[model samples]
Target: MSILNSFLIKTSSVKKICISFFASQFTLLIMMLYTFPIINSQIGTRAFDLQNLGYSLSTANQIVNNLNNQTTELYLFPQLTLLDVFYPFLLALFLSSLLFRLGKLIGKDNKITSLLLYLPLLAMAFDYFENICIILMISKSIEISKSFVLLSSTFTVLKSLLTTFSWIVILIYTIKWVRLKIMKKATKSSLSQS
Candidate 1:
C-alpha cells in the first residue's frame, strides 16, 4: 500500500469509523472556525440575530423550530454552497468513526457492529439540540453574546479534547490488536505451507 493507504489502515477500526460518521453533524451546533479569517471576512462585514433577521427564538426549542430557523440570517451566505449544507452531515460522519473503534474492542462480532452503527446516529440527534442553542445565540446575527460564546467554546473545546485523547489511546491500541491478528493469520498460513 502507498503511504496514505498504510496510514488509513493503521487508523481504521470500527470505532474510528463510527466516530467519523458522527463528527460531521454540525447542523445542530453550527459554528465555524468561529474565529477563522475566512469567517471573519465572510460573516464579519455584518452581524445578525434571530429577531432582526426575522425569526423567533425557540420557547420550547422544539425540533420544528430548529427546522424552521436553521439559518439565523436570510442572506447569511449567498455564496455558501452545498458543501456548507453537507458540512454537518460530514462532521457527524467523522465523529462516528470513533464509535467503530470502541465497538471493536468491546466486541467485534455482528452484534457489536450493529450497535456501533446505531450509537453515532443517536449522538447526531443530540448534537442537533446543541445546534439549536447555537442558533439562538447569534446577536444582531453578528457575534454571539458572551454566554453563548462561552457555552459553545467551552463545550466544543472540551468535547474535541476528549475525543482526541480517546482516539490516541483506545483507537491506537485497537489498531495494534488488529495488526496482530492479521500477522497471526499470516503466520498460520506460512506454517501450513512449510
Candidate 2:
C-alpha cells in the first residue's frame, strides 16, 4: 500500500511518466507477439490451444502433458512469466493515470474521474494472481494440480474482463478528449477572427 501511495504521488501529475508507460506497453506487446509464435511453434498447440479450452483441471493436465521435455526444462527462459509480471503492473498504473487525465479533459465529474483513476488496479491485481498461478502450473509440469489450473483459469477470466473494461473506458475518454480539443480550438479560432 505504501508503495502504491508513493507511486501515485510520484506519477500523479507527471504526463511524461504516463506516456513512458504507454510506450513500454507498446514495446511489450511487440515482444510478446514475436515470442508467442516462436513458443507456439516449439510447444505446438499446448499453451494457447489449451488456454482456449476453458479453465479446468482436465485442460491444465492436457496442457501439461503436451509439454516437450526441452520446453519444460527451459520454461523460465525466453518465455519468462516471472519477469512478465511487471507488464501488467506497470500497465495498471499508466493506463489509470491516462484515463483520469482524459476524463478531466472532458470535464468528467469527480466521482467518475475517481473511478477511472482506480479501476485499472483490479486488472493489475488479477493479472499478478494469474501469473502466479501460471508459474505454479508450469513448474509442476505433468504433475500440475487441478486446483492450480482452476485458480489460474478463474484469475485469467477476471483479468480479461477487467482489462477489457479498462480499455473501453480509456477509449471513451480518449475520444472525448479529442473532441474537446477540436472544439476548443475552433472556439478560439472564431474568437480571433471576430
Candidate 3:
C-alpha cells in the first residue's frame, strides 16, 4: 500500500513521469515477446537468422525485391520486410526513453533512467552480434550446429519482446506526465507548505 501511495501521490521531487515510462517500456518488451510470433509469422525461419542484422534484414530485402521483376533467385525469405520501418538503433533509443518514464512514475527515477541511457549501447552491441550470426548463416560459412528453426525462433521472439517493451515504457511515462501536469496547481501549493 505504501508503495502504491508513492506511485500515485505525485509528491516526489524527482522526474516521476520519465521514470514511469522506462518501467512500462521494459514490461512492454516482455509482452511483445509473447505476441510477435502471432503477428509476423511470415518471416518464419528467416526472422531468426535475420534478427542480428537490425532493420537491414528487412530493408535489404525490399531493395532486392524492387530491383528484380519477380523472384530474383535469392531465397532468403521476404517477410523481413516486416521490420523495414523499425530501425533497431532508433527504435532502441525511443523505447529506452519510454521505459525510463515508466520507471519514474513508480518512483524509480535513477536506476530506470540509467538503464534507459545504457540500453542503446547494449542494443548496438547485441545488434552487431546478431549481424555476425546473419552473415555466417547467409554464406553457409558456418554451421548453426543447433536446431536452426527453434534457435532462430527463440532469438526472434526475445528481440521482438525487447522492442515492444520500449514502446510500453514510453506510454507509461506519458501517462505519469499528464497526471502530474493536471495536478500542478495543487502540487505547487503543497510544496509551498513544506
Candidate 4:
C-alpha cells in the first residue's frame, strides 16, 4: 500500500496522470478496433459482457455450445488470445490511473481517494485470471475443464464489478473536479477585473 502510495505520489499531477490515461485508452481503442471486432464477429451474440461470461460452467458450456465449430476454434486460437491478453492490462492501467488522478484532483488531500485508486488494479487482476481461464478452456475445446470455466466466469464477474465501481467513482470525482476548476477560474477572472 505504501509503495502504491509512493507511486501515486510520484505521478500526482494532472499532466502525468492524464497522459497515462490517454495512452492506455488509445491503446485500448486500437485493440477494440483491431481485435475485438474479430472476436465479436466470430462469436456473434455470444459476445456478451464479461460479467455474463462468469455466470457458471453450465453457462460457459452453453456459450460454447451456441458457437459453430469454426467460431469455437477461432475463439480458442492462440493468435486471438495473444491479442486478448493485452486488453485487460491496458484497461486496468489506464482507467484505474485515470480514476486515481481524478479523485486526487477533486478530493485533494483525502486519504480515501488515494486508496480508491487500487480498485482498478483489482479489476485488472481478475481480468488476467479470467483471460487465463478462457484461454485454457479454448485451448482444450474438446475436453473442456469445468473448473477452469467456472473460475474464469467468476473472475470475469469480479473484473466487471470492480471496473464498474471504479467508473462510478471516476465519474463522481470528475464532475466535482470540473466544477471546482470552473469556480476557481471564475474567481480569478473577477479578481483581475477588479
lDDT of 2 by residue, 42-125 (tens): 655545322533467775666566667677544455455643555676778787766655665688846756765666788778
lDDT of each: 0.42, 0.66, 0.45, 0.67
Clashes of each: 47, 0, 32, 1
Q: After superposition, how far is residue 5 of candidate 1 from its true place, in Å?
A: 27
TM-scores of the candidates are 0.42, 0.77, 0.45, 0.74
What's the CA error at residue 194 for candidate 1, in Å? 4.7
Residue runs of model 1 more than 4 Å from their true location after superposition = 1-37, 42-85, 94-130, 139-146, 162-170
Q: Tens digit of lDDT per residue, candidate 3, span 56-116?
A: 4344344333433222212222212223213354445444544544565646566445555
- Candidate 1 lands at a TM-score of 0.42
Model 4 compared with the native: what TM-score?
A: 0.74
Candidate 3 lowest-lDDT run of ten: 71-80
RMSD of each: 11.7, 3.6, 11.7, 3.5
Q: What is the Å distance of residue 91 in model 4 from its true position?
A: 2.3
Q: lDDT per residue, candidate 1, 1-194, as tens digits?
A: 34423443444575565554554544323544342223334443322222112222232223222322234342234213332345534553554445444445545535535444444344344334334444455423334445554454443334344444444544655676788789889999999999
TM-score of 2: 0.77
Whole-model lDDT, model 4 = 0.67
For residue 37, what is the lDDT in candidate 2? 57
Error of 2 at 75 (Å): 3.4
Residue 38 error for model 2, in Å?
3.6
